[model samples]
Target: MSRVILFNKPYDVLSQFTDRNSPSPRATLSDYVQVPHVYPAGRLDRDSEGLLLLTDDGRLQARIADPKFKAPKTYLVQVEGIPDDNALAALRGGVSLKDGPTRPAEVERIDDPALWPRDPPIRVRLSIPDSWLRLTIREGRNRQVRRMTAAVGHPTLRLIRWRIADWTLADIAPGRWRDA
Candidate 1:
Protein backbone atom coordinates (compact mmCIF):
# COMPACT_ATOMS: atom_id res chain seq x y z
CA MET A 1 0.00 0.00 0.00
CA SER A 2 1.09 3.54 -0.76
CA ARG A 3 1.87 5.76 2.19
CA VAL A 4 0.43 9.18 1.47
CA ILE A 5 0.82 12.09 3.84
CA LEU A 6 -1.01 15.40 3.72
CA PHE A 7 0.97 18.24 5.16
CA ASN A 8 -0.13 21.76 5.90
CA LYS A 9 3.08 23.59 5.10
CA PRO A 10 3.58 26.71 7.14
CA TYR A 11 5.03 29.96 5.84
CA ASP A 12 8.79 29.90 5.23
CA VAL A 13 9.05 26.14 5.60
CA LEU A 14 10.81 24.27 2.81
CA SER A 15 8.92 21.41 1.19
CA GLN A 16 11.97 19.17 1.35
CA PHE A 17 13.41 17.41 4.35
CA THR A 18 16.79 19.18 4.50
CA ASP A 19 18.51 22.47 3.78
CA ARG A 20 22.19 21.63 3.51
CA ASN A 21 23.20 24.93 1.88
CA SER A 22 22.00 27.36 4.52
CA PRO A 23 24.39 28.20 7.34
CA SER A 24 21.50 29.07 9.64
CA PRO A 25 18.98 26.36 10.39
CA ARG A 26 15.86 26.64 8.24
CA ALA A 27 12.51 25.02 8.85
CA THR A 28 11.82 22.04 6.58
CA LEU A 29 9.46 19.10 6.18
CA SER A 30 11.65 17.15 8.55
CA ASP A 31 10.61 19.51 11.33
CA TYR A 32 6.99 18.44 10.98
CA VAL A 33 6.94 15.17 9.06
CA GLN A 34 8.51 12.23 10.94
CA VAL A 35 7.40 9.61 8.46
CA PRO A 36 10.42 8.03 6.81
CA HIS A 37 10.89 7.23 3.11
CA VAL A 38 8.14 9.65 2.02
CA TYR A 39 9.06 12.49 -0.35
CA PRO A 40 7.06 15.55 -1.34
CA ALA A 41 5.18 15.01 -4.54
CA GLY A 42 5.36 18.69 -5.52
CA ARG A 43 6.79 21.89 -4.14
CA LEU A 44 5.44 24.95 -2.43
CA ASP A 45 7.52 28.13 -2.37
CA ARG A 46 8.88 29.19 0.98
CA ASP A 47 6.65 32.26 0.99
CA SER A 48 3.47 30.35 0.29
CA GLU A 49 1.45 28.34 2.82
CA GLY A 50 -0.83 25.35 2.23
CA LEU A 51 -1.42 21.68 1.62
CA LEU A 52 1.41 19.57 0.26
CA LEU A 53 1.23 15.89 -0.61
CA LEU A 54 4.05 13.44 0.10
CA THR A 55 4.21 9.82 -0.86
CA ASP A 56 6.40 6.76 -0.66
CA ASP A 57 5.09 5.54 -4.00
CA GLY A 58 6.77 7.23 -6.96
CA ARG A 59 3.83 6.64 -9.31
CA LEU A 60 1.31 8.27 -6.98
CA GLN A 61 3.76 11.10 -6.52
CA ALA A 62 3.97 11.62 -10.26
CA ARG A 63 0.22 11.60 -10.69
CA ILE A 64 -0.22 14.35 -8.08
CA ALA A 65 2.81 16.43 -9.03
CA ASP A 66 2.76 16.17 -12.82
CA PRO A 67 0.95 18.98 -14.60
CA LYS A 68 0.09 16.53 -17.37
CA PHE A 69 -2.42 14.86 -15.05
CA LYS A 70 -4.39 18.14 -14.95
CA ALA A 71 -5.22 17.81 -11.27
CA PRO A 72 -6.82 21.04 -10.16
CA LYS A 73 -5.21 23.05 -7.38
CA THR A 74 -7.22 25.76 -5.69
CA TYR A 75 -5.87 28.81 -3.92
CA LEU A 76 -7.18 31.53 -1.64
CA VAL A 77 -5.25 34.62 -2.60
CA GLN A 78 -5.20 38.06 -1.07
CA VAL A 79 -4.22 40.66 -3.64
CA GLU A 80 -3.18 44.30 -3.46
CA GLY A 81 -6.24 45.63 -5.25
CA ILE A 82 -9.75 44.69 -6.25
CA PRO A 83 -9.76 42.93 -9.60
CA ASP A 84 -12.38 44.26 -11.97
CA ASP A 85 -14.64 42.11 -14.11
CA ASN A 86 -12.32 42.58 -17.07
CA ALA A 87 -9.46 41.22 -15.01
CA LEU A 88 -11.48 38.21 -13.94
CA ALA A 89 -12.50 37.59 -17.54
CA ALA A 90 -8.91 37.89 -18.64
CA LEU A 91 -7.91 35.25 -16.13
CA ARG A 92 -10.75 33.01 -17.24
CA GLY A 93 -9.75 33.43 -20.87
CA GLY A 94 -6.10 32.78 -20.09
CA VAL A 95 -3.39 35.42 -19.75
CA SER A 96 -0.11 35.54 -21.58
CA LEU A 97 2.74 35.02 -19.17
CA LYS A 98 6.48 35.24 -19.77
CA ASP A 99 6.66 31.47 -20.13
CA GLY A 100 3.63 31.36 -22.45
CA PRO A 101 -0.16 31.62 -22.28
CA THR A 102 -1.59 29.82 -19.26
CA ARG A 103 -4.52 27.46 -19.31
CA PRO A 104 -7.83 29.21 -18.65
CA ALA A 105 -8.56 29.03 -14.93
CA GLU A 106 -11.64 29.05 -12.72
CA VAL A 107 -11.45 32.44 -11.09
CA GLU A 108 -13.78 34.28 -8.77
CA ARG A 109 -13.67 36.99 -6.17
CA ILE A 110 -14.46 35.81 -2.65
CA ASP A 111 -14.91 37.27 0.78
CA ASP A 112 -11.95 37.04 3.12
CA PRO A 113 -11.66 33.53 4.47
CA ALA A 114 -11.45 32.90 8.18
CA LEU A 115 -7.90 31.68 8.34
CA TRP A 116 -5.24 31.52 10.99
CA PRO A 117 -3.27 34.74 11.29
CA ARG A 118 0.07 34.70 9.55
CA ASP A 119 2.96 35.10 11.99
CA PRO A 120 4.25 38.08 10.06
CA PRO A 121 1.06 39.54 8.70
CA ILE A 122 0.93 40.84 5.16
CA ARG A 123 1.66 44.51 4.66
CA VAL A 124 -1.34 46.75 4.18
CA ARG A 125 -1.57 50.19 2.67
CA LEU A 126 -4.28 52.30 4.33
CA SER A 127 -5.16 54.03 1.08
CA ILE A 128 -5.08 50.99 -1.18
CA PRO A 129 -7.90 48.46 -1.12
CA ASP A 130 -7.29 44.72 -1.08
CA SER A 131 -9.50 41.76 -1.96
CA TRP A 132 -9.62 37.99 -1.94
CA LEU A 133 -9.84 35.55 -4.83
CA ARG A 134 -10.57 31.87 -5.28
CA LEU A 135 -8.54 30.58 -8.18
CA THR A 136 -8.31 27.01 -9.46
CA ILE A 137 -5.71 26.02 -11.99
CA ARG A 138 -4.66 22.72 -13.48
CA GLU A 139 -1.12 23.86 -14.16
CA GLY A 140 1.59 24.17 -11.56
CA ARG A 141 4.21 26.58 -12.74
CA ASN A 142 6.81 28.27 -10.58
CA ARG A 143 5.06 30.89 -8.45
CA GLN A 144 2.22 30.64 -10.93
CA VAL A 145 -0.56 31.96 -8.68
CA ARG A 146 1.47 34.94 -7.61
CA ARG A 147 2.51 35.62 -11.20
CA MET A 148 -0.98 35.16 -12.55
CA THR A 149 -2.47 37.65 -10.08
CA ALA A 150 0.32 40.11 -10.81
CA ALA A 151 -0.32 39.73 -14.52
CA VAL A 152 -3.87 41.03 -14.02
CA GLY A 153 -2.52 44.12 -12.22
CA HIS A 154 -3.33 42.90 -8.71
CA PRO A 155 -0.18 41.74 -6.99
CA THR A 156 -0.62 38.94 -4.49
CA LEU A 157 0.04 39.89 -0.89
CA ARG A 158 -0.74 36.48 0.59
CA LEU A 159 -1.39 33.07 -0.93
CA ILE A 160 -2.73 29.80 0.50
CA ARG A 161 -3.41 26.60 -1.34
CA TRP A 162 -6.75 25.36 -0.07
CA ARG A 163 -7.23 22.32 -2.22
CA ILE A 164 -5.31 20.00 -4.52
CA ALA A 165 -7.60 17.70 -6.44
CA ASP A 166 -9.64 15.65 -3.95
CA TRP A 167 -7.39 16.51 -1.01
CA THR A 168 -7.81 19.74 0.94
CA LEU A 169 -6.25 21.67 3.74
CA ALA A 170 -9.51 21.19 5.67
CA ASP A 171 -8.84 21.20 9.43
CA ILE A 172 -5.09 20.78 9.22
CA ALA A 173 -3.31 23.44 11.21
CA PRO A 174 -0.08 25.04 10.15
CA GLY A 175 3.03 22.87 10.27
CA ARG A 176 1.09 19.68 10.80
CA TRP A 177 0.70 16.46 8.82
CA ARG A 178 -1.71 13.55 8.67
CA ASP A 179 -1.73 10.24 6.85
CA ALA A 180 -4.13 10.15 3.93
Candidate 2:
Protein backbone atom coordinates (compact mmCIF):
# COMPACT_ATOMS: atom_id res chain seq x y z
CA MET A 1 0.00 0.00 0.00
CA SER A 2 1.24 3.50 -0.83
CA ARG A 3 0.98 6.29 1.73
CA VAL A 4 -0.40 3.71 4.08
CA ILE A 5 -1.33 4.45 7.69
CA LEU A 6 -1.63 1.81 10.37
CA PHE A 7 -4.23 2.85 12.88
CA ASN A 8 -5.04 1.19 16.15
CA LYS A 9 -8.81 1.48 16.10
CA PRO A 10 -10.44 1.71 19.51
CA TYR A 11 -13.55 -0.08 20.57
CA ASP A 12 -16.99 1.30 19.59
CA VAL A 13 -15.64 3.40 16.74
CA LEU A 14 -16.99 3.09 13.22
CA SER A 15 -14.48 2.29 10.45
CA GLN A 16 -15.90 4.92 8.13
CA PHE A 17 -15.26 8.60 8.52
CA THR A 18 -18.97 9.51 8.55
CA ASP A 19 -21.86 7.87 10.32
CA ARG A 20 -24.71 9.01 8.07
CA ASN A 21 -27.07 6.26 9.20
CA SER A 22 -26.61 6.65 12.94
CA PRO A 23 -29.37 8.58 14.68
CA SER A 24 -26.94 9.90 17.26
CA PRO A 25 -23.32 10.87 16.74
CA ARG A 26 -20.83 8.06 17.38
CA ALA A 27 -17.05 7.82 17.28
CA THR A 28 -15.72 7.33 13.75
CA LEU A 29 -12.42 7.23 11.86
CA SER A 30 -12.71 10.95 11.20
CA ASP A 31 -12.44 11.52 14.92
CA TYR A 32 -9.01 9.88 14.96
CA VAL A 33 -7.61 10.32 11.47
CA GLN A 34 -7.33 13.72 9.79
CA VAL A 35 -5.11 12.80 6.84
CA PRO A 36 -7.22 13.70 3.83
CA HIS A 37 -8.18 11.08 1.24
CA VAL A 38 -6.85 8.15 3.23
CA TYR A 39 -9.67 5.64 3.66
CA PRO A 40 -9.92 2.44 5.65
CA ALA A 41 -8.85 -0.61 3.66
CA GLY A 42 -11.07 -2.95 5.63
CA ARG A 43 -13.54 -2.76 8.50
CA LEU A 44 -13.02 -3.47 12.14
CA ASP A 45 -16.33 -3.93 13.91
CA ARG A 46 -17.32 -1.30 16.48
CA ASP A 47 -17.38 -4.02 19.14
CA SER A 48 -13.95 -5.28 17.99
CA GLU A 49 -10.77 -3.24 17.98
CA GLY A 50 -7.19 -3.01 16.66
CA LEU A 51 -5.13 -2.61 13.50
CA LEU A 52 -6.95 -0.88 10.66
CA LEU A 53 -5.16 -0.01 7.44
CA LEU A 54 -5.90 3.28 5.74
CA THR A 55 -4.50 4.07 2.33
CA ASP A 56 -4.68 6.83 -0.20
CA ASP A 57 -4.37 4.26 -2.99
CA GLY A 58 -7.52 2.47 -4.06
CA ARG A 59 -5.68 -0.59 -5.38
CA LEU A 60 -3.95 -1.04 -2.03
CA GLN A 61 -7.32 -0.85 -0.31
CA ALA A 62 -8.69 -3.60 -2.50
CA ARG A 63 -5.65 -5.83 -2.02
CA ILE A 64 -5.91 -5.57 1.74
CA ALA A 65 -9.68 -5.84 1.95
CA ASP A 66 -10.29 -8.55 -0.59
CA PRO A 67 -10.47 -12.15 0.59
CA LYS A 68 -9.05 -13.32 -2.74
CA PHE A 69 -5.64 -11.95 -1.81
CA LYS A 70 -5.54 -14.26 1.22
CA ALA A 71 -3.86 -11.60 3.27
CA PRO A 72 -3.40 -13.08 6.72
CA LYS A 73 -5.18 -11.25 9.54
CA THR A 74 -4.18 -12.25 13.04
CA TYR A 75 -6.16 -11.56 16.19
CA LEU A 76 -5.74 -11.68 19.92
CA VAL A 77 -9.04 -13.07 21.09
CA GLN A 78 -10.42 -13.28 24.59
CA VAL A 79 -13.10 -15.92 24.84
CA GLU A 80 -15.78 -16.82 27.36
CA GLY A 81 -14.07 -20.04 28.38
CA ILE A 82 -10.87 -21.98 27.81
CA PRO A 83 -10.91 -24.04 24.65
CA ASP A 84 -9.81 -27.62 24.43
CA ASP A 85 -7.77 -29.34 21.72
CA ASN A 86 -10.83 -30.52 19.79
CA ALA A 87 -12.31 -27.04 19.67
CA LEU A 88 -9.01 -25.58 18.51
CA ALA A 89 -8.72 -28.33 15.90
CA ALA A 90 -12.14 -27.44 14.62
CA LEU A 91 -10.97 -23.87 14.13
CA ARG A 92 -7.69 -24.97 12.58
CA GLY A 93 -9.50 -27.37 10.29
CA GLY A 94 -12.16 -24.84 9.33
CA VAL A 95 -15.84 -24.84 10.29
CA SER A 96 -19.03 -24.44 8.32
CA LEU A 97 -20.68 -21.05 8.52
CA LYS A 98 -23.88 -19.75 6.99
CA ASP A 99 -21.78 -18.34 4.18
CA GLY A 100 -19.80 -21.56 3.65
CA PRO A 101 -16.93 -23.54 5.11
CA THR A 102 -14.00 -21.40 6.10
CA ARG A 103 -10.41 -21.97 5.06
CA PRO A 104 -8.23 -23.77 7.58
CA ALA A 105 -6.87 -21.22 10.06
CA GLU A 106 -3.75 -20.98 12.19
CA VAL A 107 -4.94 -20.92 15.78
CA GLU A 108 -3.52 -21.51 19.21
CA ARG A 109 -4.41 -20.83 22.84
CA ILE A 110 -2.57 -17.87 24.27
CA ASP A 111 -2.08 -15.90 27.46
CA ASP A 112 -3.53 -12.45 28.00
CA PRO A 113 -2.03 -9.82 25.70
CA ALA A 114 -2.60 -7.03 28.29
CA LEU A 115 -2.37 -4.35 25.63
CA TRP A 116 -4.86 -1.63 26.63
CA PRO A 117 -7.87 -1.48 28.88
CA ARG A 118 -11.01 -1.34 26.77
CA ASP A 119 -12.88 1.94 27.51
CA PRO A 120 -15.85 -0.02 28.80
CA PRO A 121 -14.40 -3.29 30.01
CA ILE A 122 -15.78 -6.54 28.69
CA ARG A 123 -18.29 -8.02 31.09
CA VAL A 124 -16.89 -10.71 33.31
CA ARG A 125 -18.75 -13.64 34.78
CA LEU A 126 -17.65 -14.53 38.29
CA SER A 127 -17.89 -18.26 37.80
CA ILE A 128 -17.10 -18.78 34.13
CA PRO A 129 -13.41 -18.68 33.37
CA ASP A 130 -12.02 -16.79 30.41
CA SER A 131 -9.02 -17.49 28.20
CA TRP A 132 -7.16 -16.10 25.22
CA LEU A 133 -6.39 -17.34 21.73
CA ARG A 134 -4.17 -16.19 18.89
CA LEU A 135 -5.99 -16.82 15.65
CA THR A 136 -5.02 -16.01 12.09
CA ILE A 137 -7.27 -16.21 9.06
CA ARG A 138 -7.04 -15.12 5.46
CA GLU A 139 -10.68 -14.24 4.91
CA GLY A 140 -12.37 -10.97 5.90
CA ARG A 141 -15.74 -12.42 6.66
CA ASN A 142 -18.27 -10.63 8.86
CA ARG A 143 -17.43 -11.27 12.50
CA GLN A 144 -15.54 -14.33 11.37
CA VAL A 145 -13.25 -14.72 14.34
CA ARG A 146 -16.11 -14.25 16.77
CA ARG A 147 -18.25 -16.66 14.80
CA MET A 148 -15.48 -19.22 14.59
CA THR A 149 -14.82 -19.09 18.28
CA ALA A 150 -18.53 -19.30 19.01
CA ALA A 151 -18.91 -22.21 16.67
CA VAL A 152 -16.43 -24.10 18.80
CA GLY A 153 -18.40 -23.23 21.99
CA HIS A 154 -16.07 -20.47 23.09
CA PRO A 155 -17.70 -17.16 22.31
CA THR A 156 -15.21 -14.34 21.96
CA LEU A 157 -15.51 -11.64 24.61
CA ARG A 158 -13.01 -9.21 23.14
CA LEU A 159 -11.46 -9.41 19.67
CA ILE A 160 -8.37 -7.51 18.58
CA ARG A 161 -6.97 -7.57 15.07
CA TRP A 162 -3.23 -7.46 15.64
CA ARG A 163 -1.92 -7.92 12.13
CA ILE A 164 -2.99 -7.71 8.51
CA ALA A 165 -0.84 -8.98 5.67
CA ASP A 166 2.75 -8.05 6.58
CA TRP A 167 1.72 -5.06 8.72
CA THR A 168 1.21 -5.18 12.46
CA LEU A 169 -0.08 -2.89 15.20
CA ALA A 170 3.29 -3.19 16.96
CA ASP A 171 3.64 -0.23 19.40
CA ILE A 172 0.62 1.74 18.20
CA ALA A 173 -1.60 2.45 21.17
CA PRO A 174 -5.36 2.76 21.00
CA GLY A 175 -6.63 5.59 18.80
CA ARG A 176 -3.11 6.27 17.61
CA TRP A 177 -1.55 5.64 14.19
CA ARG A 178 1.64 5.78 12.17
CA ASP A 179 2.37 6.06 8.48
CA ALA A 180 3.98 3.01 6.93
Models 1 onward score TM values of 0.98, 0.98
Candidates in order have lDDT scores of 0.95, 0.95
Over 11-128, each residue of candidate 2 has an lDDT whose tens digit, in order, gives 9999999999979999999999999989999899999999999999999899999999999999999999899999999999999999999999999988787788998999999999
> Residue by residue across 46-151, what tens digits does model 1's lDDT show?
9999999999999999999999999999999999989999999999998899999999999999999999999789999999999999999999999998999999
Give the clashing residue pairs of candidate 1, or none.
none
Q: Poorest 10 consecutive residues of model 1 by lDDT?
A: 171-180
TM-score of 1: 0.98
